[model samples]
Target: MARNSADRLLRQFLLKAIGPIRRLGIPIPAKISKHLQFRGVVDVSVGSGASFKMQSHGHAIENRMYWYGKRGHEPETFLPWLEASKTAEVVLDIGANTGLYSLGAAATNRTSRVLAFEPVPRVAELTRHNARLNPSSNIEVFELAVSDENGTAILHDPGGDQPASASLRGDFLDCKQTEIKVRCVRIDDFLSEVNLSRVDLIKLDVEGIEELALRGMRTTLQTHMPTLFIEVLDARPELMAELNGLLNMGYQVGDLCSDGVIPYDLSDKKGVERNLLFAKDLSRFQ
Candidate 1:
């Protein structure tokens, strides 16, 4: 009981000190700031009158949002993500690291139901805690990895300050510190089991197994035709091949840009890493 009271006092003190430090433009190194300023769950103002609770230490997503806010974290994707969620009723956030997109979606649209899937256990718990911190109850966190199969799989964690880099693929991290066995589920099966008949938007960022996750959700993609937001890094040949299939299914691919989306060409050899939007109609975002 005494420990809890002390913790609450420390939390209150840190919260008070963070704003003044930020306003004064104190240039504290990120390494030091993580330990001192961003310990425990900290409240953050994420712009447009939206505030969120985040764990300041360990997870980079929370750390990034702590220092830079939401818009500053990933403007290209985060902005478009917010825009798309306005019309969505059901949002699937696969590879939901700390539930940023999920929380943003739920906050952007109070009626929208956000299903956040994160394979990492610790990060998944943090996402749930953050969800509870907010007033909205639309976000539901699932601590399971989405893949082509339903069985358990080995997930690689890069550890250290990069908790969001966990992936089901071994090649995803060169500095893999530990392996975790996580439950796997296909989007199609999971949706059916949950009795969800329709989905409006889907954001997939499962690091290396994006193609496999796409395969798992084939039924969802073909039937629901929900808009897709995918993060492609270096345009891996395998994932590109799967994306080509999506194109054949009447989905147009384009990179989410500041002004608008740039059309994506699969034939282009020098493909850079970026978030790509796949939809039957690309003008909706414009």
Candidate 2:
């Protein structure tokens, strides 16, 4: 018990000292900065007229954005996302971690509608808070998970400090025993319920349940044929199934590059690329 208290005190001291260290311009190593956890919200600008609000709590995505803007977080994905957002009338940000993509998309096109889905309660609230921080942007925060079916699912969260890693699958990421039951919905049904007829682009990164969510939106995929920006960590069975599903629907796959997207051969089992673009028409990205 005494050891636990000592450790708690040490952590509190360290968290308090980070601010003064930053004020002194002391260089904090990436490894150390990653583990530094605290609670606070701040508005960040990525230059131009693009900007968003982010809450800091050791989340890699928000921290990177705070330090290096969208480029540092996921330039390959974010750059294309922002470009697509400029003209997209409707965007769905599945697994919207703290409104990074949602707010940015809304900022790029204030008239466009951005629907952000986050299952974790606290994380969803954080997204809402970030949206509120940007009053000019049109972003809707939904505290629900998108899946193949409409029901409730156990969302596994590693911890409060690792909100970005939360997922529907219990085994996904380094999920701890901590879990929460969150409402789930099929994309098709949800959109129909909301009376949204068009979806210009979709940013899907739902940890390991990507396939299930895709399955739920099969109708939308066929009808809307929206441009898709997805994180493909590797060729898992679930991911491959959905990739094949899209490919069979006449969607071409490409790897997001600094210049633009290039055709990607799915046969390469090595899984070198972490992100991919699936679209019926690749010219939109060019």
Candidate 3:
């Protein structure tokens, strides 16, 4: 594989220019951050964009990494919901991750209410902070993990320049172990406690724990039938099964890159690690 001119230039700029600027503690502007296109760069924009009072809490809202004084990448899946305000009433942000989607939804007046659920303590705190920074009463932050059961679990925290997915099962390049006390709640259980009868949209990115959360939301899934945005990781078989389950439940499914819902067939198990969307009705968009 050969690197194109643009790729070579971007790499050189990142290593030579952007690296030293970050070391110098200089804050990059949102517009310049767009070039990096890495996950870490994307995460950093969450904080920077919020500080600058920009809506659409993408990776910029999470990490605040700036490339040439610009904020990082934005998740394309959120564009549709952001563009159409009135379509969504309540949003469920599973694995909220520094309040990107959560805060973004709160920024919109049409998003009546937002419930952000994050299990990681530090990330949860950041989510709360982002929510407060935005100043939306409709947003509620929960420092709990959504799983199949309710209990305490050990979450791995990989600390370093970028400390994400501490709960995941893997070794971090520059990381350490930290014990985070997390509450595991099912969707039905939490919604019942909050008295939420229906949810308009649900976004999940809990690594491999998505299936567990879906299992816990059986009642709500059958009833409200909210539009769901899910990140499917290739590592989990149960999560794949859960996607099959959604298809069996009469929901139309599509990936974020697609224009509309396509039939989900579990037989095609290639490229499971992609962002996908599911909805009971496409008319919701209309």
lDDT of 1 by residue, 1-286 (tens): 9998887687568657776876575654666445444556755554567665656663555656666566546778887788888889999999888778888788777798999998898888878887887756588999999999999999988875438678887887788358899999999999999999999999999887888999999989999889999988767787888888898899988788776777778777665677889988887766
Candidate 2 residue lDDT tens string, 165-262: 78787777753567789899999999999999999999998988888999999999999889898877678877787888899989989888776788
Worst 10 residues of 3 by lDDT: 43-52
The candidate maximizing lDDT is: 2
Angstrom error at residue 187, model 1: 0.6
Models, CA RMSD each: 5.0, 4.2, 8.3
Pairwise lDDT winner, candidates 1 and 2: 2
**lDDT (Cα, tens digit) per residue for candidate 3, span 109-219:** 434798988777766777776676566437898988788887777666655423456553434224557766667888988898999888888888876677888999988
Candidate 3 Cα errors over 4 Å, as ranges: 1-72, 83-85, 160-162, 168-176, 258-264, 282-286
Give per-residue lDDT, candidate 1, residue 81: 82
- Clashes by residue pair, model 2: none
The lDDT of model 3 is 0.64
